[model samples]
Target: MKLTTSALTPDRWSGEVLALGVFAGDDVPSGLSWPRGADAPLRDAVARLLAHGSFSGARDELVAGPGLPGRCERLVLFGLGRAQQVTPHTARRAGAAVARTLTSGPNRRVAVALPSWRVPGPDGGGPGGPGLDLVEHLAEGLSLAVHCGRWNVLPDRFRADYGSDLPQEPESVELLGAADTGRMLSRAEAFTHAVVLARELVAAPANLITPQRLAEEAVGLATPGSRLSVEVWDEAECRKQRLTGFCAAAAGGADPARLIRLHYRPAAPVGPPVAVIGLGLTYDDRGVLRSGGAVQGAKKFMAGAGAVLGAATALAAVGGRSEVQLLIPAVAKAAGPGALRVGDLVTTASGATVELNHEDAHGRLMLADALHLAARLGAHRTVGVSALGLPVAAALGPKAAGLWSTDDGLAADLTAAGYQAGELLWRLPLVDEYDDELLAPFANLRAAGPPSGDGATAAAFLRRFAPPGAWAHLEITEPAWSPRIDGYYNAGATGYGTGTLARWLCTR
Candidate 1:
């Protein structure tokens, strides 16, 4: 949808739908300003709607009505809850609610008058000073929600007649009384495009999105004259580089393994390049012996790769001085004659020998090689994103990802970026006590640790390969894919880390 800013007040705005965001309690929010003697009819309509005592202005609550509004066909009043409790996430949810309510109708235009609340402080106590703009977050939510509505319209192999009757989203959206609308909308569009690309990559079937296909998509992101450059390493090149761990993990797959690298360099450099590595298991099938419904979700094994590539796409469009390197080790794990068996010893690029005890634990192997390569490439800081362990998902649930970092400053920066991007992150300790769980009798490390505190142990294992400067690990499983449409998330891949990574890169 096209997004634009309007100088017109609510009374002068004419559209198919005019959405007004109201805060809790009787008083109107201070963010909504009016010119002298203007917006009286709109104010009266809001006051009358509130006076009826039917709407309490609770979060996500909606009350719509017709008539008594100038030139507008419909009026939508969405609740923003308490003023003090509002944040960028609040605006995002409010925007999603408005889009979901009005998109199914014949309305082709919408005007939103939502308050641009301040972000939380460093301590997350309350609204700190002005940092990120709420209008950008609102646009992100609206665009994402509208794009999600059309996700069902994609061609499906199993159901040829699927999503034939789905309604289209509005053609244009105007942000009333918004500042810097063009720049904010441009950034929002970049983020939306990246996130939608990530979702599509994760939602595709394994047969269609193999390692080669993923490499092709990465190459496609680097258009001529762009700041991004793409490179891919084939099986021979990977072996030459001592990427034995990745090669072992992708041993038996029909598709060849690929090491995809994307580099984004600005016109002028600022600091050392930050490296971001993502796990690229296109399809993970535990092993030949494993069976059940668990493998059905194997298609999402590459969610981390999708997120990093998406971030690369966004960063390429939104120019930044910080040089960024994105790495994805695209490989597939399946039941085949060349598959690594239990008790097999695999040597990683870091010269660490690992005892492969579990077939499903191969992601850590690929990540280990990637992390070592990043450090070898002289990156000042490195961040690895993956759905590596279930213990993290069990601890944080679906709303937040687990963060483990060796550098406190990097951790703080990531937390702030995640907050600004509307993605929640909970810091988990990288306890040294769990290091014993990864110890092997004959090898330097064991593939799988004990079930208890496995998340911490897994982080500890990856920490061995972390760069000496600064490094972080983001375990994003539950937050990357959802089973239902909750808030701004659709029923599939949520593209969770793309926004956070993009925000972090640009801000840095």
Candidate 2:
């Protein structure tokens, strides 16, 4: 949908209907007073009347009554209890509630007088006053509510029977404030587009999203003026470079091996650039090397690769940023004559040696080369976003992701932004204690090893490839795909980090 804002004027701005936001106890500002227009449609106040309406605020309705204004068919009064506790998230819910409620009726447009937020800086007003850019915040809220449904997948029968009956179709928002409504809407649109792209990229079948396909996808990101350079290295190049660590890990996959790299440059050169590395294991059948034959088990490994592709799409869509170099080690883990086995040693691009500890722990091995490549590319702060393990989900639950980063500031920023975007992460320590688990007598790092709830071990393995003092960000596996029905997100790749990375770049 579209969103725009206008001055709270009654003269040139009188419309058929206008929706205003009010806190539980705040007075209606007189600036929005109307002068009884000739063909005014109605005036409405949306209020949270249900006792526990906060959680399911949108599930409530717009109660039309007699206590209204001239030609005022309805009033929408939203609840903001203990106003001091209201945050951006609250604003989002309030916006979603209003939008969802309005869409059910004949209202085609809405003018929201966003509730003012406390300003932390002098850019606008004062603290606890009409502060934080409500326009942007509201737009983000609307975008989330609208696009959250696209990732959701329901039983075909259930959807075919009742999908059209659902009321939560996407909503378009219009800003009624002085802030740059056009730009805010455009950014929101881009964010939504990025989310859609990530979801689609992840939702693709594993066979369709193989290593070569991933490289082709990266090349597609190198459009004119995008400032991105893309390249793909085949198995031959990997073999010569002794990427045994990565190749050994990919030995069981049926797809051809590929190392996909993307380079992004900003118009105005900044300080040392940041690099994002992802584990692009297109498909992992757990290898016939192991006896278990589960199609879903493959998704566990594919999720990591999907995370990388999603991150790339988001980075590409959010174009204006500092220089970035991304390396994705794309390969499938399939059993074959050439597939490396356990106890084998491999050397990384950084010249570090690793032992094939376990064939399934392939994400870390591929990241070895990616991390080395990032360091060689002069990455000041390196961040790797991956679906590393299920232990992360066990630890952080479905809502929040587990994060391990070397840079405290970056970690804090990422965690805070994740919370804001609703797809959040909790800061995890890369304990120096676990550093020895990655070591092997002969290899730089080993592939086969013990499995523990400590998903950060993957990040610990990747640290071997990082240059000293380089910050690293690792997202232990948080199943981006939901096996069951979620309110807005269906049973597919949720595009979990797309918003997080996009917000990081925008604010950075």
Candidate 3:
């Protein structure tokens, strides 16, 4: 959706739908000041609803009606709970409610009047201060909620199949606020646009987004005079590069594999480049003779690749000084026919031997090769991306992803980035003892060792390939996607880490 900042009030804004926040009280929210008739539509809607005894404005309470009919079309009332308890997260949810409500029908345009999220505090300024952050994140929530990431659209029968509840996204969004941050809001929309791209890539059918397709898509990122540079190492080059672990994981797939590398170069060279390696498993079919490998959901295995690519895309759009390279092991983890066996031991370009235990844990092997390649590319700082629900996602549930890092500073930075982007991440340990979990009798390590510390052992395995400096392994998972659209993220691929990745890399 096209997003823009405007000073227009809900009363004057002529749009298909208008959304306004209502605090849980009889009095109007004191945050936003307006002249006479500025908030007439909102006030009138609330007054009418109050008369009907259905507008108590409790937290999360939503009231929608044909307020002002033709001129405004519809007005949605969102409860903001208590004013003192309002926060960024609350604002985001409120925005999402607006998006979901607006997109459920035939509305093609929306205007939102968000109350100032600033809470007066004793320190003279609000905790989050007065700026465009509230509006920015609110806009992001809306953009994500109303976005359509589907590659296949049965246009005429869309409603018949998916129902009108699922949205194709409104054509435009108007965020009515006094803050004159048109440029900043535009950048926010650009960032959201990239995130939506990641969601689209992840949500697409696996057959359509094969390793070859992902490679071509990376190449497409390079435009004339753009700072982004793309390179693809085909299966042969991967063999030449001695990426044994990647080769093993990619074995049974008849489709060719690719190690897609993208570099965002700056005019002036800085310190060592930061590298992000994503497990681009386009599809997964496993042979779990070792532990009864029951692999399912092969389609969205490429979620991590979509995230890092989305981050790179957003960073490229909003120019950054630091050099960043994204390494994607664009290959399918095919099952049956020559799939890596349970007892198979593999070596990587880094010469680290890893015993393949669980076929589902094959992702770590690919990440190892990519990390080694990143070191060769002069990246001392590296990040390996994993989709949500790798190992024991139940530990963190749907709210936060797991973060494992060799450096405290990088871990702190990444955690902070996740929080700043409203994507929660809890740091997992990289304990010295966990390193022993992967000590294999046959090889230098095992992709997975004891179940004692499953997540940390995976990170320890990745630590083997990390060059010096700071190395972090991000284990992320998205919320469940539901056929019944629940908020912006239903029961499907949540381009979960794209925003956090962009926030972390762009700021650095």
Estimate the TM-score of every prediction.
0.91, 0.78, 0.88
For model 3, what is the error of residue 90's alpha carbon versus the real structure, in angstroms, after optimal superposition? Answer: 3.2
Report model 3's TM-score to 2 decimal places: 0.88
RMSD of 2: 5.6
Q: Kindly report which residue pairs in candidate 3 clash with one another.
A: 285-335, 387-476, 388-476, 388-477, 480-491, 481-490, 481-491, 481-492, 482-490, 482-491
Expressed as tens digits, the lDDT of each residue in 216-281 for candidate 3 is 888887886669999999878899889887887788874778899999998885777999887787
Off by over 4 Å in 3: 24-42, 53-59, 81-88, 103-108, 117-132, 149-160, 287-296, 478-484
Where model 1 places Cα greater than 4 Å from the true spot, the runs are 26-53, 67-70, 115-128, 149-167, 287-296
The lDDT values for all models are 0.79, 0.59, 0.71
Write model 2 residue lDDT over 1-101, tens digit each, in one string: 55666655322343333545555444333212222231233222222222223322122222222223442333454443334445555555555555544
Candidate topping TM-score: 1
Error of 3 at 250 (Å): 1.7
Model 1, TM vs. native: 0.91
Write down the lDDT that model 1 would get: 0.79
Which is better, 1 or 2, measured by TM-score?
Answer: 1
lDDT of candidate 1 over 1-508, digit per residue (tens): 7888886666777878888877667354332232223466766666655555567567888877662544777778888776666666777888888877764455687888755433342334544544446678888888887777454322443323325332257889898878556888889888888888788788787888889989998999899767999999998999998898888887887688899999999989799989999898888776213325554367667889988988888898887787888999998777687888888999988899999876576788899999998988889989999876456766788789999999999999999889878889899998788888888999998977887777888899899888779999998877888887877777778888888888888777
lDDT of 1 at 104: 47
Order candidates by lDDT, high to low.
1, 3, 2
In lDDT terms, which candidate is top? 1
Candidates 2 and 3 compared: the better one by TM-score is: 3
